[model samples]
Target: MGEVVFWTIIRTAIVLPLLWVLKSYLNVDLWWTVSIISVYGVIIHPAVIHYRLFNEKNEEIIEDTLCSTCEHFDKTAVLCLKHDEHPTRDYLPCDGIDWSPKSSDKSQNVFDE
Candidate 1:
């Protein structure tokens, strides 16, 4: 996910300046159409593809692992926040001993009450 976002930012950085430069040479109607198409093809399409690939590659860790339900799990980065390590199906950063449930406002309220 981070990779997808980072690359999308790179593409946007490159595409926006080029589009700005081209606007001077093209007519309004033509430039608007081209800009929209180029933004989608160069920036949006690639980001979508990368995001899909990221999800495919991490599907197991995301869906089947204990870390997926843990409070320290970071689904976007596939990282364990507590151990600062990536979790896989066979390996857990803290070996289950440190696993904790996700904290929610409801749970906190119960404890507070």
Candidate 2:
């Protein structure tokens, strides 16, 4: 997720200035359309694609691993927040010893209370 967001920011940084430069040559109306499409195509679409690809690649870990149900598991980044590490289908950062839920953790105590 961070990688996806990082690259999207990079794409925006590259595209926005380039589009601003295009404003001088293109008419205002066409420039806006081009800018919109370019932003969507270069930044939004690629981010979406990257996210889908990341999800597809990590589907097994995200869905089947013990970390998947842990509180520290970050589904978007497939990371274990407790140890600040990425967990895989075959490995865990703390070997499940440090696994815990997020701070919002209302579900953690559902049965406890």
Candidate 3:
């Protein structure tokens, strides 16, 4: 997720300045058309593609792993927030011992009591 965002920012940074430079050379009508197309093709399209690929790559760990349902798990990053580690399908950072169910009501852990 962060990688997707980072690269998107990088692409935007590169594209925006180039577009600004091109604006001075091209007429208003042509610049507007080219700017829209270039923004979509160079910035928006790549970001969307990279985001889809990132989701596809992490889909297994996000859906099939025990960490998916744990409070400490971060689905976007596929990370164990408590342990500050990335969890894989076959590996857990806490080894299930520190696993806590995700609840909207601020559920308490047994150890917290």
Best by TM-score: 3
Query: What is the overall TM-score of model 2 with all chains considered together?
Result: 0.83
| Best candidate, lDDT | 1
Per-residue lDDT over 1-113 for candidate 1, one digit per residue giving the tens place of the 0 to 100 score: 77899999999999999999999999999999999999999999999999999999999998888898789999999999999999988999899998887787449868989
Model 2, residue 44: distance off in Å is: 1.1
- lDDT at 36, model 1: 99
- lDDT by residue (tens digit), candidate 2, 1-113: 78999999999999999999999999999999999999999999999999999989999998888888787888888988788888887789898798666555656578578
Model 1 alpha-carbon miss at residue 42, Å? 0.7
lDDT of each: 0.92, 0.88, 0.90
Q: Which portions of model 3 miss their true places by more than 4 Å?
A: 104-113
- How far residue 20's Cα lies from its native spot in candidate 1, in Å, is 0.3
TM-score order of candidates, top first: 3, 1, 2
User: Candidate 3's C-alpha lDDT?
Assistant: 0.90
